[model samples]
Target chain A: MTKKIPVLFSVGWNACINCGACVAICPQEAGFISPFDTIAVDRPCDIACMLCEAICPVTTITHELAPLKTN
Target chain B: MARYRPYFTLYLGSMDKQYDLVIVGSGPAGATVGRFAAQAGLKVLIIDKRQELGAPIQCSGAVSRHALEEVGITPNAEFIQEPIYGFGIYNQIGDCTTIDYRQLKGDEYGPEKGKKPLGYVVDRRRFDRYLMTMAERAGAIVWLKTEGLGYAATGNGHCDVQMRRFNEFLTIRTRILVGADGLQSQVGKWAGLRTHIKITELASCLQYVVDQVETEGLLEIITGHEWAPGGYAWVFPKGHGYAEIGLGVIPTMTQQNAQWHLKKFMEQSFFQKRFKNARILEIQGGGVPLASPLRVQFADNLILVGDAARHVNPITGGGIHTALSGGYIAASFLIDFLQEDRDASAKNMEGYQEQWLAALGNKMWKLHGIKTKIFHNQNIVERDQQLYATMSDYFSPHSEYKKI
Candidate 1:
């Protein structure tokens, strides 16, 4: 039997503007980043609330739509 | 026998005789109320919780010269930092445009004519103390280091205000109270008024005083997420070697700490290359309420003014002038209430609501709509930069000029 892990939507690295809207609106505190040091502050988005997707003005966020299977 | 047994009497305690009117917080609102009421011969007591009158100030200290002129306050050598002949804008793509305030159309927010400039960016401590001094000169009793604890309302009508001064509890009884406290005002809540400001409707702000800027007198304003998202960064020349370098963002888009965001911007590609040797002086942070027309700002015997009433402009986030205007209006309504013999209840305070709405309510509402429309764009960051560059010429002049 395979265990299922929650999959999260991720933003395109090149399109990410570092606006931080995703981090501000996320209820689960999953979206975290360091604005001062870009590229070093990416984190996993465990909560599937999609708050970031709704707030992304340019719609750069991509929904995974499927949970990853865990060993 | 007279049909009445001598009614047993109950004493509600002796009235505290400190002042007829007590104003909490010595910001622009308190100062205006104190100045006007004191000049009207009403005994006014002004109290501030801070050890000093205006230490740890929380404002950019920007104001229009016209606003001070209306209040009969003049800006001389001590207050005026720069005349600011024009405004500057920079886009995400690094395009720069300049706007001359003197050549602009529509109702503007500064002095009309003079070599001295349209607005002043004074030292906040000095400006606040100056206003407090003016109120004192008008016969208002100044009580520094005094903190307003709570409002004590009697079943009859008057209120006993509990204040702590130098570890001693003092009571002041007044027929009227003016709450000039800032955004986090306790008076608004204590008076049963709504203090709800949605996060999306707030501007998260952070500023730093930096020295040794390359730009001489030119104020630089940068837009786009490259610096601040849903907001802008400004480098206002403060004469000598100092400049107010800050950034702001609509609360909805601002995550992480404000200071961290500011530091990140300072280290950005543009700023780092230009401002390398500048020394950091002071760091400050605060929020500006941007909720169009606030739901409520008045209640029984209490009128919220300044940031307390959400008087800040929605688009510009410039509030010093509005706060000054609010102070004056709050004073006017208070004067009327002082002269009237009627009970100073919520019904009577309605006059203030009407007067404020007449003056600044509609402008704030229109600006709110403009802000909502501007923020909803999928590509606002790029669009804003374009808008700023396009309108730079129109924003330059002082008088009404067409946006070309």
Candidate 2:
């Protein structure tokens, strides 16, 4: 059974300058900034990596640990 | 809303027509190219991802007068905030080595042709708007709120570009696709070019535009691991008591984010004394690619310019001059490439890369090497005195880093 899992979320505390830093650095292509420059850097981010959190220039992204459910 | 109505449908209509040139991103680089190409009679279309061009202020707005003049813009009060005469380099403990530009000697990054003042801090929004305006006035159609999805070679000396505005999608068939989008260039990536900077090669920066902080009219550059590891902070005077206090840190080297480091840096007694009663105006964050310039900046009628091509100086994180120059080179080449009936193969586009290398790419590579040796040198990551000595030696226009 899976145990600890990392969940990603936008801290939402920082303003999205729409700089596209996170989108450029996401090796997994888990994030993107649209033409409208929306705050969907991680609209539905799946955490294979937390590079977005580490490299967000404004510190607007981070991760949390969650216990995995098993049968 | 200025951004609504979907430009994909409004401008191109339902017809599938091919433009001579299509540029993504309306920043200095994109607009410069658009202006030149359109003025030369190329059917040009420039698209921007934002509703209002130059909104959200993603840059520091500092550029040499030569940068503006090179792009054919005259320096005036409309955008010039203040002119800097020199720099004051400081270390972690606040040791300062102030140098006046008139008294200094350096190999490059010097005052251009005896131009007074090293550079001017600008209102980036106004400056950016000005460039885009020039592009539109030169007959290039400017479409806001349009995003370039990707592009592909039609395999017939033309390329197809896909873009979206709101919920609508449109395809722009063009002779050449120009990528001027910022550091993270999805278009360049689709063209099979290296578009992403290694996390270690990235400099994450946060800045606060505040009033009542004295900057002594000189750009105050601060260094040291305690404040900014693998990068540095600066205090740029905006005129009269307003200054932008900002710092950049290598994401991979620091355990803390830019905000955390900024907070710690501000909490220092030195900053506390200086920032007392200061009125906070605005806060901004951005990232600068501190890697070597991208070697292959073009592919099969697809070209990358500005930060999209990683043209920024690795040591100083400055891109304005290179962006304007590179945009000009790319546009000039595209004019001849199209008029001379040249094929769209990557080999044919080699002239753009060669011209850019002789003009600026070589300098950028040298800066990248020096940066790796000084700023990101893991061996001296914690050595304060040694770090400041080398950083100041290379960074100052008055001092030569080679002597060190």
Candidate 3:
């Protein structure tokens, strides 16, 4: 059986202001944002929880379900 | 996503922990309430999602001396960057106006006649940690890097709060909950409180901390449509050749965002030369709600304070003082409700709203009106100049502007 993962929606990077609110609020530490850059500090983990999306002040982060491929 | 379900279930096993009050966010408001409640002997727990107590700084960190006094905080030398005595307002057309603290009247939160400093620019990161230390000393349990995910009001008036600490899930049972989670509070949403602020009522802001910059003690405020269409730009000195340069804009009024305006302001002839050799230390940005307080801030087993309650000053976008006051006020009411009445029902918490209104509601409403008038006019620079020039006469010393 293939597993599933969470991915950043298309609008995530463009809409993100790099406020780090998403990074702070993410329960699984899925988001990696930095004040020095406009992009994510690290690739977000595939945590299914949408806390980052729910807590984004600008509604910048969103997520979608993706299949996890077996090696 | 499905791969994480089993991990979630593994962490869901409840660890028995309970408190009389649980406050979220760990900012000034949460720390203040936690300190007061713990000092009064209540079992209090305060949590913040941030790894550091105050990181990814969101504020310009200006607060009046009286605001500090009202919350029982003495001006600590370590965190105070500079003492401000007045403001220097400049227009795009090169008009200037200055308002001195001495010209202002005394209000409930104003300094005494002989007081030399009207306000101080602070290091917010240090200041917030200092407040958390106070709460810790007073016996409040603080959990850094803990995010409050959601909560459910148990039928008996207690709330079961679900939280995530890094990868671990935990549950906390509390008699009362306070949401100090700021402008986009998840706590407010989970509590079913009406916490929405219209887009027109929000100010999007961005700032840069520059070192080796030339600055005087007085704060410099620049205004004009060309500078910041719906708001203003400020250069607040942090002493020893450091300053915070920032601007705010109402998104609805301008085609450009705050960052665009800030860049434009920096390139202008007046500031370009000064910033040429200055070192950019850090960048900060966030949104602030510029509106009246939420009509309903209390629900069954819950209360909202600070920016979560939209307690920011509508005109100045200042919230630190109000957050402190609101936290202290909420703590008082919670003490009365929990200790005196031995109840934490929504009904018992109504006093929090009532008392807060008596303290700040009327003033905030009036400022909202003034802010509306100021922002709607065509000549914001001229109107702002006139307003500041006559502020000593038009507003009492107790005005929100004085404290903000």
Candidate 4:
């Protein structure tokens, strides 16, 4: 059986100011800043563009988007 | 584009079932328009997600006096942080070029003329709350700690809005819907308006309030890719010897994030000398959409204002002026549409877009052109002196103030 790879992403809520930068810049609408001043990035679109990771001001959006990074 | 509502939501109503105008986000744009619509004898409802108004501020707070007057706000001592007399602009090569507004404007702006200032930086928290009060005093019903989820157009220039108040869900209907929400305009998205803050047109920003560093009345602005790639760093005075030191960067232009860029910016000898013994007072970070002005900002029953419409200045990342002006413009058309034939159709709402473009759209496009030609290009990164020469021509004291 082939081993399954998982979609990789994490949010460092401790560093998140809850400014909603990621939410505003995500073209895929994949991210949202929680009401408790925390952030969650769970959805991965067909392209997995990773624009959220790039546009995050604090670099809090970490995602292992494949092919683009899996050299 | 239409969104279908659940059957359960159709029967949910704990408050007033409807309003003439329903506005989301009680920021400058939302509150201003809400005030006008209410003042014009329309039943208006305004809501905000923030428990407190303008908490964790996300602006440099600088606005021209003419801008405030245009919005009918007489500058009061209550929220005015400091009066900026000029700019302490620095080139990438460490050369400083300062212009005193008094000297630039001459007799028209000097003490002999009147108590005029180049601009004033106000406390955003207090200022936004002041607008909320203004909206409420004008007969607009405001609900705090309420968040707008989405809206569904119900034909004939009306919409059914979904929102949450604490644990209780709220669904309110309105003949005219206003999405004055800031940068993350989910209202526009839910209403099916193209309001995305694209990555190419995004500027990731970070700012800090620090004390113990004495700054003058002038706003210190530093330009160079070494500090903030495709963006700039600033020191906006916040009184009590404190200043908001911040920088923005085009994420696509650099591998590093805004935090990394700010860290590197502060570590430089120029900033190091200023913040040697400074204590951090507050830290905030956000994004500014430096995109070209939207050609269309309304659809059917819904109209977008402020950052939701990408109204921020493309080159400076400033929006208070246009944001305030946009509220007035929206209210102008809205008062007629809602009270006249009660028509909030896409055809009628297009009038709002036309008026807004006539006021500030061309100037914003010009700034976008300059932004694209220089900062976004990245080819002119090393030409510090050349950049200053061209910038002075456009931004100098003698330059056109209307475009600024």
Candidate 5:
């Protein structure tokens, strides 16, 4: 059986300004910013591109290539 | 002939003349890339079709402050007018809301004092010339009145470009080609890349730089079905008692000319009641691509930048800043390719795409999609009105209101 590539994702909490530009520009409809809820990254649909980082005026979004390791 | 010693080197590579890079257009994208690369000691050449610089300005000349810093250019105070604190967004029904990007806080938001301008409203002709001058100062050779007719692959990954400058057809051999030409770019089509922007996704625009108009400080955005179906009208203050008044309509919405509609809008009750008798000093018209974001930006030894690659932000129909950002990325990638001593192939260029996509492309895609749904929705007007109705009691007096 061919093994599937495990998806990886990370967003820096300190860097998120809740601009919603990411939510607006994600082609896959995967990025979202909500006033009442945390924006979650669904690995299967996430392309791991950080276009949100560039357009964000506040420099709030930073990405880590691999998912954070659980202690 | 005296003993021809097989003059050519490699399968198709020729070492006779080499340019570190060749950018097809002298617009924002090409100028930015040329400046950055030439500053780093790369042989860069930028070509433009127009005899004079900044002729026939296509854009509305709006860009964010953050975009300027990314390209290492500082904004002069004289260029800025109407310090945009926020956007006053009116819906199809004439009700409105405001989104304050300034409140978020950053260098882009201006100084922490009372209020500095969010960004400047510049004369594109002067601005484009300024950027081109910077590129020239950085050692990039600029050829004006030159048209890029076509390009041929020189066996290897390099290319032989055929261009006409001042009635002279010249062929240039370059290591890499950057397509910064705006929409209808022949460089993009010649590369076999899909640069075709559909009519439905295009905005036909006409703007008048009017003097003696009371534009005030606020950037006025008039929204309604009757005003502009798929696009909106803007009144941006250009300081010195003049304002840039314009309206854009989606191509499908109008078989009638854009300039004619603009004249009607000017005469209409909504605009003419106050700013009557405003003299129009200049009239400009052009196309703004609104296809959202493209899926790919590179192929073979070529890379596309600015409108040539469809990098315009869908929500605002603004691309100057984004294109400058793209220029920076393209220059960096070219430098890396040279350092690696590898011919710029798809694999090498893929890194450039990934870096940009990771930075701006994916978000542009999402934003464009959201803009499509919101702009095209039947209930958008009512929904926005309802949101505004509840705003009075929802927040403190000190807090700012956000409108989309």
Candidate 6:
């Protein structure tokens, strides 16, 4: 089993209004609305930098600590 | 040198067109001025960076009935969501004090007495579009997705405004320029207008449009450090089951950010249960100036209004009324000056500041004083308690609350 990070990004897709405010205010460019008009996070997320979480107008983007997997 | 020559040559001939007046930003302030100026037969052009009239909505969408009427706007079903007759103020510990407009003393309720609604929660997108439409109908040319990059005074009573329309670069000349852009206005800076508000005078806010919120026709305001340090949280009901729940905070007063405060507020004992069955429909955030208007709003051939001029109520963070009123005031002066063929210099435009001060500046200053005293009180609980205790005094006809 491969070791995975203990945290993951979760998006409440239904709550997103596709306002693009998150995209404009995010300092890391970590989050954006897809061409299909849905919220999407960039790959290899900058977990330490929480600017996306802080600036999200709707609190759509959040993080949850994952349980450690046993090998 | 040859490669750079073509681009430099292109810049030299970029001036595209000219207008009598150029207004930037299509919010209520800009649109209001555009409408009045166009109606007066002045060649006007209004531009906004947004593709749509109202995207990434920044306001809670609450406007007083009087404010709408003052701007010559009548509330109809298309935008008015709910009519609010009163409000409730709450503390961190779940203590609430309610104020009913009907029970208030004196002429504060206007001539309609108990019949009129105190305020209304509106669909901000539609409302902003309505204002823009009005401007367009009044003969103002509106350009969307147009951003003002910078400007230069041509020194001949006109300015050359550089702009970017989507992918194209362009410039428009205008005898007079108006900056109605919201907080963080670049126009104010480009015009060399001294309109800087201290960081402590700004409120960072975040709000959500939610469904399944059960409430009467009343606005809810929650205060205290736990709710929002140096500011307050609000729940403006938008008819049916939808409501706008948001809060603002002075950045320097709290280590935690507005997002943290909002999340904690949603999970609070009082609000957690209410929001459990609720669904958030949209999210919006922006900064508001909680200070007095700028001392100087006019420079040579330029004027700043609305949030760009810091014309927000420091205590309540309300700017729509002032913005609308300021737009009208600016138009009245601009129309007179232009019609008389007066030079659009700083001295000629000084009347705008004087007229605006006479209209709303004193009220804003008084509110700023009250806001300072309230935020300075160290004990949150005691402050709220004292506020609740004095809530009745606000209903008095002679009270300063009546002025607001």
Leading candidate by TM-score: 4
Please say which candidate is ahead in TM-score: 5 or 6. Answer: 6
Question: At residue B291, what lDDT does model 3 achieve?
Answer: 78
lDDT of 6 by residue, A1-71 (tens): 55445344566777654544333333232113343223344333433344445444455777666545569
B102-153 in candidate 4: lDDT tens per residue? 7777666543546587778889898888998899999998888788887778
Per-model C-alpha RMSD: 11.5, 5.0, 7.8, 5.7, 16.6, 8.9
C-alpha TM-scores of all predictions: 0.75, 0.86, 0.80, 0.89, 0.73, 0.79
Worst 10 residues of 6 chain B by lDDT: B388-397
Residue range B13-32, candidate 5, lDDT tens digits: 33234687889888778899
Clashing pairs in 2: none
Docking band of candidate 4: medium
CA shift of B332, model 2, Å: 2.0
Which should have the higher lDDT, number 1 or number 6?
Answer: 6
Chain A only TM-scores, each candidate in turn: 0.57, 0.51, 0.56, 0.55, 0.47, 0.51
List residue ranges in candidate 2 displaced over 4 A: A1-17, A29-31, A34-47, A63-71, B1-16, B102-115, B379-383, B395-404
Q: Which portions of model 5 miss their true places by more than 4 Å?
A: A1-71, B1-17, B77-85, B92-115, B378-404
Q: Which regions in candidate 3 have their CA more than 4 angstroms from the true location?
A: A1-17, A20-71, B1-16, B102-116, B269-276, B378-401
Ranking by DockQ, best first?
A: 4, 2, 3, 6, 1, 5
Q: Residues B1-404, candidate 6: write the lDDT tens digits.
A: 54444564455333338999999988889999999999999999898877787666878888878888987888878888888777787777777777767566325542264467888888878888999999999999888878888888898889998888766798899999899876656687777676555556667688878898887777788877777876778888877778888898776677777778888888874878887777888777776667777888988889988887877877778888888888999888889889998888889889888898888887788778766676677787777665444433443334575534
The candidate maximizing lDDT is: 4
Q: Judged by DockQ cut-offs, is candidate 1 incorrect, acceptable, medium or high?
A: incorrect
Error of 5 at B18 (Å): 2.6
Ranked by TM-score, top first: 4, 2, 3, 6, 1, 5
Q: In angstroms, how far off is B115's CA in candidate 1?
A: 2.2
Candidate 3 interface RMS: 7.2
* DockQ of candidate 4 (2 decimals): 0.53
How accurate locally is residue A46 in candidate 6, as Cα lDDT from 0 to 100?
35
lDDT of 4 at A47: 42
lDDT of 3 at B278: 68
In model 5, what lDDT does residue B266 have?
A: 75
